[model samples]
Target: MWTKYSTLRATLKLHENADISQYGRLIAFLKNGSKNHKPKKAKVLEREHIQQFLVEAPNTKFSMMKVALLFGV
Candidate 1:
């Protein structure tokens, strides 16, 4: 919707020489209407999972990533 609105706005400005400032209120409304997105929570590894991962990680193809995973966890 925002993309379509932007395209329509650009078309009007280019073809009709319309002043976009007239739609300030509508723009504000559209901006506020799209702010309902919620952020996702980060997943945490369990202590047992971490222990098992450390135990088996050394021999895996991704062994080099163990240090990075340890720091990230």
Candidate 2:
């Protein structure tokens, strides 16, 4: 098992004043999970399970930053 961190900076995108969603969200796309951001979980058996877990992780900490998540495999 490994650990990772979410990118509060990249998701914030301070460089651009992009328009947020009607509910206030970013439209930027990412090819992979953020290198710094990842979700917490117990041991897993498959990679697919990792993907699913990360997707459902609630942003309990940075609930306001709209941070992007990433993981280490």
Query: Which of the numbered candidates is closest to the native, going by highest TM-score?
Result: 1
Per-residue error for 59 in candidate 1, Å, reads 35
lDDT of 2: 0.44
lDDT of 2 by residue, 1-73 (tens): 1121124444545556532332222223232334556668897558776566566656785434334434231
Flag regions of model 1 displaced more than 4 Å. 38-73
- For model 1, what is the alpha-carbon lDDT of residue 4? 78
In the predicted model 2, the residue pairs found to clash are 5-36, 5-37, 6-37, 21-25, 34-70, 37-70
Best by lDDT: 1
Question: lDDT by residue for model 1 over 1-73, one digit each (tens)?
Answer: 5877889889999999996758788889888988996669999879998789878765567676677777884
TM-score (all chains, Cα) for each model:
0.43, 0.23
